[model samples]
Target: MNIGGRALLNGIMFQSENYTVKARYDKEGNIFITEEQTPTILDNKFVSFMSSLPFLRGIVALFRILWSVRKIFIISFILVIPFTLLLQNYKVINDSNINELTIGVQYLYIVLIIIIFWGINRKYGKFHGAEHKVINTFKRYGKVELASAIKTTRISSRCGTNLVFIVVVLKLISLISGVNSPLVNLSIWLVAYEIFELQETKLAFLSKPFITIGEFLQKLLTTSEPTVYELKPAVEGINHLIKLERTNN
Candidate 1:
């Protein structure tokens, strides 16, 4: 599949009944992407149904967006109570326990990374029309609009989720370390969480540099250019009234 910028697995392009796959690589690593080729059975059915009711389709689209964010909501609910308690019981450990503390922090870091990946991918997938625009713009422009496309299509993100992930990680570390004094641990966690949030914001500000580099690498590896397919005309006389108006006007 075409991954970040390298070929993957047998180093061949392949297509399945429903999807086309390609691979690519960069200095850091490789990535394989499976892109859907055809509308699914569900997509066909939904389009047919929505065609009969345009207003209802809008409602469905909104609901689908909410459904996509359900995971983030669930995680918040699961951790809120524990996080509060962890803050209440926070304590500072001595140098002797620093190693264990570091380990706990590391584990939390891993979990936060996983959470960020999951959240971003999940939200990114739901940008149906936006994804098409991104692919098309990238193909036509020759690597000029990748970051703008990504930012335009990313509708749900607002910097809050990143902060939330960092806060959750701090709470998780406190829970893992089993530190004495709930209040002390809680205080430490809150302080660290705030600092992490600041760091994330600073990192976010620097995102454009990374996007530019990635787009350059991506263009190097990409072989397929987005093509516009013509739609077949419906049976003649199907829209005779519209045709008449066009002729007269």
Candidate 2:
């Protein structure tokens, strides 16, 4: 069976061909990267309760995204300092803030995000590469071996890097159009995902421009070619899950 994995804080996570492993990490570094042998009411009931309060649940979800990025203190600093500068420069110095579209805030945000990513990528891109290689090799083959997995390219169509870009685009569009709504956000994500899937399959030439943007995001901000040692965590994660599945059976 194929093995697939994703990178997470302090480690990477993998799944055997039979199951799903989500990237949901909690405080204390606990994660939903593995499946329990049995389900519980707490899981079902809590999900139902959370679903009933969409807005509150959405806030919690936003916290989860923020918490994931809290590791990058420098990025956080870059984000805050620039916004403050934008406010200062674009301000009336009296009563109101800039209410219209301007390159100052939006461009600064994109630039800062890229700058932070450039630094992070150089240091940790190898692990990111390994995560992709392992998953790609497993999805095409059936297992992961360090020697073989190392041969795969780090680029992935379903990368979180692409998702990051999607969310950024969605937010910017929502801001500019003044159409901020959960339903709109969901629709944008779904549409973006479908476009990406099309590029992977039938609409290759038509989606080249969009795919190029994502590729740049991956190349500059998301990944680098991995070394064998960098692949260890991914290999181990895949093997660990496979071992559990064998025992469970």
Each model's TM-score? 0.24, 0.60
What would the TM-score be for candidate 1 when compared with the true structure?
Answer: 0.24
In model 1, the runs with Cα more than 4 Å from the true position are 1-27, 35-47, 77-249
lDDT (Cα, tens digit) per residue for candidate 2, span 72-169: 86587889787768767766332443443343456577677878778768766777778888888777777778888988778887676775676567
Instruction: Estimate candidate 1's alpha-carbon lDDT, on a 0 to 1 scale.
Output: 0.38
Task: Pick the TM-score winner.
Answer: 2
Single out the weakest 10-residue window by summed lDDT for candidate 2.
34-43
